[model samples]
Target: MIALLNNLKTYLPFSLLDNKAFKRIEESAQIAYYPENTVLIEENEIPSTFFLIIKGIVESKDGEELIDIYHNDDVFGGIELIKNQPSAYQYKVNEELICYEIPKEVFLELCQKNSEFKNYFFSSIVERMDMLKERKESAKMADMMLTRVDDSILHSACIVDHTMPIIDAITKMENESAVALLVKNESGYGIVTDADLREYILHHEEKNLTIISQIQTYPIISVTEGELLFNVLLLMTGRSIKHLPVLNAEEEVIGLLELIDLLSHFANQSHIIHVQIEKATDLQSVIDASKRIDTMIKTLHLKGVKSRYIARLVSEMHKKMYAKLFELIFPHEWHDRCTLILLGSEGRGEQILKTDQDNGLIFEEGFEPKDQVEITLKFTETLDAIGFPRCKGNVMVINPKWAKSTTKYKEDIRRWITSPGNDDLMDMAIFFDTFAVAGKISIFKDLRDFLMEQIKQHKAFLPHFARSIESFESPLGLFSRFVSSDKGHKDEIDIKKGALFALIHGVRALALEHGIHKTNTTERIKALNDIGYMSKEDAGDLLETLEVINTLRLHSQLEKLEKEKEIDNYICLSTLSKLERDTLKEALKTVEEFKKVVSYHFHLSMVG
Candidate 1:
């Protein structure tokens, strides 16, 4: 009874439940035991009571036999009883079973008297429904996951020369299931299936068919062996074809895949990740891996690694794995055609434990790769699968706008910053902290040089970018007082959204105004002092405040992950210790100072 009550407590509306409530529920229920092989409930029978299993086991069966067994605090029958439906299936004793049977009326009275208990009951039912639905979807997905090209369909195919004799070809067909053959014709190739051979043999039709080319089918639907199973399935379904010839880039036939073979490979969570990474054998692999970065971070954190060091390791491995995946997918000839460039924190190899993909592509202009679309798509997809969410603003290489030849890319940047607009200035703001990750480092250096040259000469883009920085107001009131919301986040205030983004955006704008491209918030502040962008005292204060906010947000994220809750920038103000709340209040005050600087630089006059 204690175990059952404890488990019930987990689903209740409140996090904590008292011993008194548990004892009350326990005293009200009577424990009973049933012998093995006893029928508890039958399919199509109205359920009258809720059985909260205390010990032993009960089996649930559908049709002829048992499908599932439950033990311990497992609850059954309540859902059916409330719904007034025949039990979905039959329940029986798998072993001698011990349970607490609560009558329907008693259960209803318990819910009416206790709000927490009611919430727990309803939530458990909803959760069970959701779990069942998820199971069904998971099963469907698993079935579709093992998509492969069927070899049986391909077994009916053979590549043949046009000069083969009809009789010899017919004899060959008898030994091999190859009902069809791809034969070289004057234009290209033709396919002749088993039916064509039968017609030729039975009707004595076209014995002089000197070349099987005359009747072979033209064109073939084919894919590389490394193609994603999901994609292969999609193609097969779209084209309504069962067979796809597998070929190497050199156009040499490696094997043939049929729909049945494709469908045989089941989709497991790990399998999707494995396939995505494998297919990302080009620039596309890294791009795809970048998308799921947050999930990857959370998973790693859950495995009990320290946060700070984990970020560095995750970023480096991310780069290395992406490179490896690309190498696997790229045709051998084009392996050295381009270099990947990592910008921002990634370029500096200083990424600490957060999801950020700041990268671009640089390749020789004339390279004009044939598989550009396919290869890059694989890259982006892999990144997404591995838990790196896609960048909403498009800083990654999968965006064609960012994939540029070295020369063209440099020229584009030079033009954007020099001739600024709202969009142009924003683009330059992103490029300010760019750093090289992979590929030809020289191209990135040249691009940077062109950008700096233009920035130095133009001198106008900075203030425009700076002007837009003050859009986020500091969280303080008229007399520099900490403004607490009367009805804000249920019990907590999000320190990140309310404090961090505001500070980071302000500091970044200030850094760009001074042409200081340091990516780290702390480093950027120190840079501001060195260049006289801000006084030493102001820099020191701002840096301290920003660090505190960053630390709090990171801790909050870690906490949320531990509880299996969704993460956001919000910090619960109510849960904070007194010292932490005071620090956040001070951080907001620092942000107010930041607003003044932004306003002065942007030359915006205050209103009201």
Candidate 2:
């Protein structure tokens, strides 16, 4: 019984079980053995026992087709046992087998007594697998997840009336031992820090009675109480501000957040990297700053920062870098005349690492400058030089078609709508995800409104748009085994195709149909759920599945980077743990389910 408990601990849900529960399972379970080819559970029969394979391969078949193969540590009959229905497939011992057979009633009692065990069976397979993986590292990540800005607030803010003299305010700051002082005025509250005082003293020669309001920064930047500390760091880094006032929901100031306070909470290097990018003046400086991004990503991941937040932080850094590049290359005057647009994943804010540049430019109608071609070509070349590779399909600003006037873009969009082909539809879909990173974003908004209107009017185009969701088959075998790549690496799977694209595009198609303007997949999922196009449960499952898939892809890319190899989408299954393999299977299953939902809604089968 002790040996059985040890073996059970090696598998999921059991591994999560408490000692007492494990003892209960050991007492309730009975050991059983069967010769090769012995039938364990037959199709159409109610499952009376739940078997955990101890040593053997159990083949599951649906009629004549082999659906799945289960090896040691895999549990069978849990589904039918829980559902109180007949087994969907037949299970047979492929090799001589040794197993623990728990009576159905005993299993049910265990499930009822153990919430964790019940959750494992209740959750989507991907989620359950993820929970199991997280259990191993939850101790480390628990502190990070619990950390909030309020926890890092060190001192009560020193407040001063706006009319108070600078010298008097300084005296209050010194008495309170505060690095920042909040100033109250008729307009609102503002903050003045030591940095502001230093700058004021250096720039001004007046020694007589300078009021706090005159020198203090106006319209103060702040964070809300209970906000994540990591997010506060990102905000401060992006804005290049050290001190932030913590405000409550009622807009009353609660505490002050100083850089030193956050420094004590997180020993993160990403913030330093962000500061370097902000101070960067030239292209080489920007390049030097860019090199630290990969290191920062790894550091954050090791710190247990979630994948979505990492992607967002990385995207913010990229945005700042690109803004700096634009400032360096093009004159400030050219900024307003054109909109710099990011397409695809970058636009969606899901880009975790450097990939090909899918970008474009939308100029004001008939507002072509003499140096337009030269400027656009130089921009693309500089991007390639800065490690953003050029788009292979020429979907960049260097292409005259993509770097067109707003009028010209409208015409192109109209053409796409009126004459939809595979190529045009792909282009339209890509453009739909566009986000203006630098420029008058309203330009992009006007075009986006036009695009959505066209889409709404052409209801017939929905089927064609939705058909792309079915383009890539979910790489799950009939019985939920992973269908690995046949072309390049046999043991690898194209996670982007098998899981990501289906979720992204399926959600995208639905979002477009409902006029949801959000580009991020997670946001789109939520919006769809809010508008009643998708149920809350389905939305959550889809988002969770996306997170799991993206996390795997990011980890795979990081591994490739460590090896000094080019990163690609194919994930080597052999490298994943047994838990990850099971989770991947479940994630892929979610993608298939989402695809069916989209197909049914769009009635894709009715299309010619």
Candidate 3:
């Protein structure tokens, strides 16, 4: 019994239990063993005991269909025991099984005593699953948190008295091999960097006689010894400064922090890639710089950065690449006359990988260049070479239909609103997510204002737009199990159609109706909530659901790339952890609930 209690401490959530609660569990638990193929709990029978598997595997079956497999250290029958209801599935032993069985009454008593344990088992599955995943990610980030600024600082303080001459300070900085020097005066301390010295030398020829205090930057920016290394990096980036003084709690300067030191310690590949992109002068060099994005993304993911922030960073890099391409291909004069618009995911700032090129061109009326066709074709070819595939629907600027003047786009919007059909609605949806990546943004703004006015005037367009979400059903069954793909992949489901499209389209339709111009789904939900179109709680759930779905899709794509397979949105349930599976189910359920709300608001039933 003591050994069992000791083993229980190694498991999660239970490890959080107090000693008294653990003692209660140990005293009431019984050691049980079963032969292979033994039936532990049958469907339709109420569970009287909670089983914590110590060894072997258990298969959960709904009739003849396999629902899930439980391995060692997994808990079963908790939900059934909590609800005091019949088991939904039969728990059958797949191998010789050993378990610690706790009585239902004792488990209930433990729940009453330990709120954390109770919450883990009884809270909403989504919340519990999210907590578990966060705990796992927190464990992974623990080591990074231990890295302090003091650990990364390479040199001791290089200090100069306030009365010291500028020339002497420079000599001292060079002697110490320090990029910056701390200057102390009657008031306090300040920092003088290499850049500051260069500027001082450039402007003043009498550097030898000049006091260091006059040229040194005052009001020192410094980090404490115990501050996390990552936070220091963020501070430096935010301030656009490369050097900082490391101070003790008593305000005494102990060390100096140089950007090179932090960069070497963190080895931020993204920063290196950004520098390379900025310095690249040729198309091939830019393309080469773009290829390092995958590694950067993977590194960020491992560092436990949130998915939304990762997407934002990736989008920023992509925009930089596109802007560089434009600089190389288009003349400086032409840039002011044309608006380069990105449609769909790129415009929405949610693109994490190079998928498709959904872009167009908008020229000021009567300012269309005669060589537009040749230039756009070349631009599209360059983008394709950079790994962005051409849009299957020919949404690229290379298509003459998409390359139009602002006046023509306004007319197109009017036609789409007046004569709404499947293709027109699809085109309108795509255009609604437009963002100007380069060139004249005011031209795109004019078209956007005109679009909102037309959409508001034609009230019938809302129902037509909202009805499109009905094309795909939530891929969850009545019992909350996944509705597997019908395309012969039994274990896989289309996360894009089943969850992503539903949430995105539903929120987008609402945002358009309410005149909220935010293209990102999460931001759109917030805008909807602010306008009283959605409850705060519902909007939060929708945002979290979108995040989880996107995270799962990204992980699947990364896995595919790791295995040298083609990337797609299909996720295999067997490949995921049990916690992730539960979270996904809950996320899909939220999507379904959101769809119902959207349908009720738009009155989609009256459409067709």
Candidate 4:
């Protein structure tokens, strides 16, 4: 009884229960044993008991296919038992199974008495990942960072004496518009920003506010004028700061190195677009704000910002647009009732410009499709007005298949895993890549966790999933010379299908297998590398390859857009410089190598 109580406390909400509740569960629970290969629950079989695995592996198989594996310290049958619904698969004992089977009456009683326990079974929602994880500081110009930091690169500092009033320093910084002040204090030098001033105000009295040095950060990260520009960047990034004091050969404070200026080397008005999106109250205003994104993308790309960074910024802007649009259109009451999610490139944060809308919505369990069908339809239409084309596959929230409660969607996904059809496979791929953009994101998290759990049980799913990497032929030829399309676009390659798709989908498969929950290809690669799935050298090669491929794809789309032609993924091979073509060839080779790696890793040899 003591050992069982301790084991029960190891799981959540059970851990929340008092000694009395523990005693109740212990007294009611019955230990049950089963031989290997025992079928516990068949298809459509509603279990009357909740199971806590003490020792064993129970494989949940859809027909003959192993779909999921439940191990010790895991609970099962809660969903079917609570909903009084048929189970989707047969639960078979893979080994001699030992578990505590608690009757539904006992389980339901505890659930009724404990809101937290009830939520774990029903909602399963809690705090999740932030929409934007803290971002690492990035500079677009790799070679530019190598340039020596000279006076020309420096922004003039607002020099202030230590004796100067705090208000005077504030006025100087404001007047300069973009700068940190170099404060000459008796206790040596320091740097201060308006942010520093605001922080000081919180802790000190009004009279102490007049003292300027009190707010300045002493010996703040600084760099010499002749040091490499990247040195400043590294310092600022490491310190999580924007402003740094630049010093001369004699250690004389010369000016400030602002991160924004260091990155764009020119004023970036992208923040203007963000402010517009945020401040927009009406639908048209939000639509109008979104129009500026394409122009910003062009400007950033032209300014030599890395395509990856541009995509990250664009993804952020797009999410803001989505959240803002939903805020304007959806009823305030429904705001917390649903989560907006993006699919395809949009979902992966690789979306630069879109050929279609790649978005959906996940409603809480109680939400009815009929109640807000018109609003969901209008939301899709409004996005269309804002320049996103309708998805070719109709994956938008307006589609009943895409817009539904988390429970209904999970059922569809479970079916998708079991179906051998290509369309269902495609649907599975799309769903796996979803990223929540707006609403009570817990809705998306609950659904995502469900998918992951299902994927865990379905052992045959990934190998078959990994087989889709073969959908498109490798871009390289017999000798790895350029392989151009023979279709309407002559001498052109569909960079996405030829190169990007294979790399992304391959990485996606590996990520799923390793349970790396990240959606971005680059992030997934880094995570894979960190967890010893891929060597550092291989990971670095793939990352560089992705960067090159993304740059080429974006450049092609931009040029096509400029010509008023249909913007697409095709890259004109003849247009690339010999150096670029060579780099691309190398990148394509890396894709080929990685595909083979994924195929072998997933044992796709047996898949066919």
Question: What would the TM-score be for candidate 4 when compared with the true structure?
Answer: 0.58
Residues 1-608 of candidate 1: C-alpha lDDT, one tens digit per residue: 56655655543231234566556667777788899988999889987787877677777888865555565656777667656789878899988988888777766666566665565545533243333333334434543445443322123356666777666665676665553566655554455666666666665544555546545556666676556678887898898766566666676555555555455333112222333444443544444544334444444433333343444555555566656655665555555666666655555444544445566677766777777778766666665655555666777778876677767777778777666666776666566666555455666666666666776777656666666555554555553334456364565565655666667667777765566656656677788889887899998788767656655666677577558666666676544533355466677877777777777766656321
TM-score result, candidate 1: 0.47
Misplaced by over 4 Å in model 1 are 1-337, 343-358, 478-497, 513-517, 531-536, 601-608
Ranking by lDDT: 3, 2, 4, 1
TM-score of each: 0.47, 0.66, 0.69, 0.58
Q: On residues 451-546, what C-alpha lDDT tens digit does candidate 2 reach at each position? A: 999988888887888788877777787667778756867978888888798899999989889999999888999999899888889988888888
The whole-model lDDT of each prediction reads: 0.61, 0.80, 0.81, 0.79
lDDT of 4 by residue, 1-608 (tens): 56876766635546657787788888898899999989888889998898887888788877776656666666788888877899999999988999989899988888878866766665411110010010101223453445677654455578889988887877877876645677897755888876786787786685456768888888677788888866766777788888878888788888777677566533343675676687677887778778768767876776666788999998899989998988888888888888889998899988888678998888898876455688988998898887888988898887888888888898888988876578888888888889999889988988888888888899788888889998998778864456776579887898989989899999998888888888999999999999998899999999988988998888889888889888888899766633356567778988999889988888888986
RMSD to truth, every model: 19.4, 10.6, 8.9, 24.4
The model with the greater lDDT, 3 or 4, is: 3
| Global lDDT of model 2 | 0.80
Score residue 180 of candidate 2 by CA lDDT.
84
The superposed Cα distance between candidate 4 and the true structure at residue 80, in angstroms, equals: 75
Q: Between the candidate structures 2 and 3, which one is better when assessed by lDDT? A: 3
Against the true structure, whose TM-score is highest?
A: 3
